[model samples]
Target: MSARGSVTAGRARSSSRDSILDSAGRLFGERGYSSVTVRDIASAAGVSAALVMKLYGSKEKLFAVAKPTEALLTDLDVPVSELGAALVFCVLMRRERGLREPWAMMPCTIQDTPRPEATRAKTRERYLAGTAGLMKDTTPDLRYASTVVALMTGFGEAVRTLGLFDGWDFDELVAHYAAIVQAQIDACQLAGQD
Candidate 1:
């Protein structure tokens, strides 16, 4: 093929890969990881199941790579002090009616798989890394970081699993939850000073 043809082909491949990942992310968020098949992702992306398997190797690998946590965390774009509100925005307030944040569903995904200790370990490490990054110079103790993560995850899961906050006003719920999260961050900051 000509050089121009090669470039075009590369672009096509990249586009297809992105489409597959996007579709997989959405499907996984909506249906939970175990429930979503590569065929389902392929259908959503308007591609063949074989193509997805060929590109990602397998369903588990695809789920691991297609996790949206890194993107979701980076997109917050706020100071460390306000990270809680940012998280609340991404995981809770920003979703459509039925869509769940992929990261918020990750623990459930990890639970559903057999012998996923390695995956779970990686996820725990990533969670700590990401939280530490958000904590910045706040002297991020892993214990506090884990507690903060649990708080955010608990709130998000409560909203998702039990519709715990659905009846409350959106702004009010976010405010109260963000305040609670902020308190944790504040406590961490105070502890760091000692």
Candidate 2:
């Protein structure tokens, strides 16, 4: 084949792969990780199941391409300089939505698979490392930022398991969570020797 032909084929292949991954992401986000299949992704992307299998190798491989860890990173509402706060906020929001989030779901994804699990570990580590210093600043409130994120995540899961989401309003819940954080920060600043 000519160079032009090769280039065209490459472009088509990339587009198809992108579509497959995109579809997979949406489906995974909507349905839990275990429930989504390669065929589901392929059909959503308008491609053949064989193509999905060939491209990603298996259902797990498909997740490797479409998973939400980095996607959450991209959606964080923080600046590069204030990554800790951004990460904290991101974790809070995700936890508010419960573990159905990329964080919780990714763990579920790796729960059984023998595939490389390092990426999953690294992601969780990165968030903790990223938020370490900022979370430590809660003297008045003592660990307010850090505690909020941790509790927020745990609360979501606990509530979801208990089927409590139906009665909750996110805005009110976030406000309630924020109040806890503010009290911590205030306690810290007030304890200063000034």
Candidate 3:
């Protein structure tokens, strides 16, 4: 094959790979890992199952690549006093932009997958650890960090997954929810100082 032909083929391959990953991410996020199969992702991506296997080897490998571990709060520089609002605002903005919060899918995965223990471990390592890191300056208590994580996860699930507060004013929702989160943070900080 000519160099031009090789380049075209490479681009096609790259596009297919990207499509597969995109499909996998959406399906796993929506339905959880065990509920989705390679053929399902392949069909969604408009690629052959053989191609997916050739590229990612297995469902597990594809999941590892597709799972997102985005830091819960991208900008952690917010003052502790305002961290609640910042965190709530970030999540709401992402929802408005139609972004998926993979950590919010943990409950689905835990309930749906056969290997619940493994799923729980992954959640702790990837999701909880990352969120806790963002709160390191506010408190060193794992219990407090876990509470914050729970609140965010529940909030995301209710807002995004369940559409509990659809059509609500963004600012109003954020203010109400952020106040609850702020109370938790304040208590944690006070406990730490004692």
Best model per TM-score: 1
Q: What TM-score, over all chains together, does every model reach?
A: 0.59, 0.39, 0.56
Index of the highest-lDDT prediction: 3
Q: Lowest lDDT 10-mer window, candidate 1?
A: 67-76
Better of 2 and 3 by lDDT: 3
Q: How much lDDT does candidate 3 score?
A: 0.76
**Predicted candidate 1 versus true structure: per-residue lDDT over 12-125, tens digit per residue:** 889989999988876664445656888999998888999899999999999878753333554455676777766676565335334455556878988887868987888777
Which 10-residue window of candidate 2 scores lowest in summed lDDT? 79-88
Query: Candidate 3's residue-wise lDDT over 1-194, tens digit each?
Result: 99999999999999999899888876665445666899999999999999999999999999878842233554355677887886777677567646676546768878798898987888776665665566553454477678877898899888878889898898899899999988877777778787
Q: lDDT of model 1 at residue 185?
A: 75
lDDT of 2 by residue, 37-156 (tens): 888888989999999988889888777667433334433433333443333344444454343554444445556556647765765555444333343442443354445446545544
The list of candidate 1 runs beyond 4 A from truth reads 1-71, 137-141
RMSD of each: 10.9, 11.1, 11.9
Deviation from truth (RMSD, Å), model 2: 11.1
Error of 3 at 1 (Å): 34
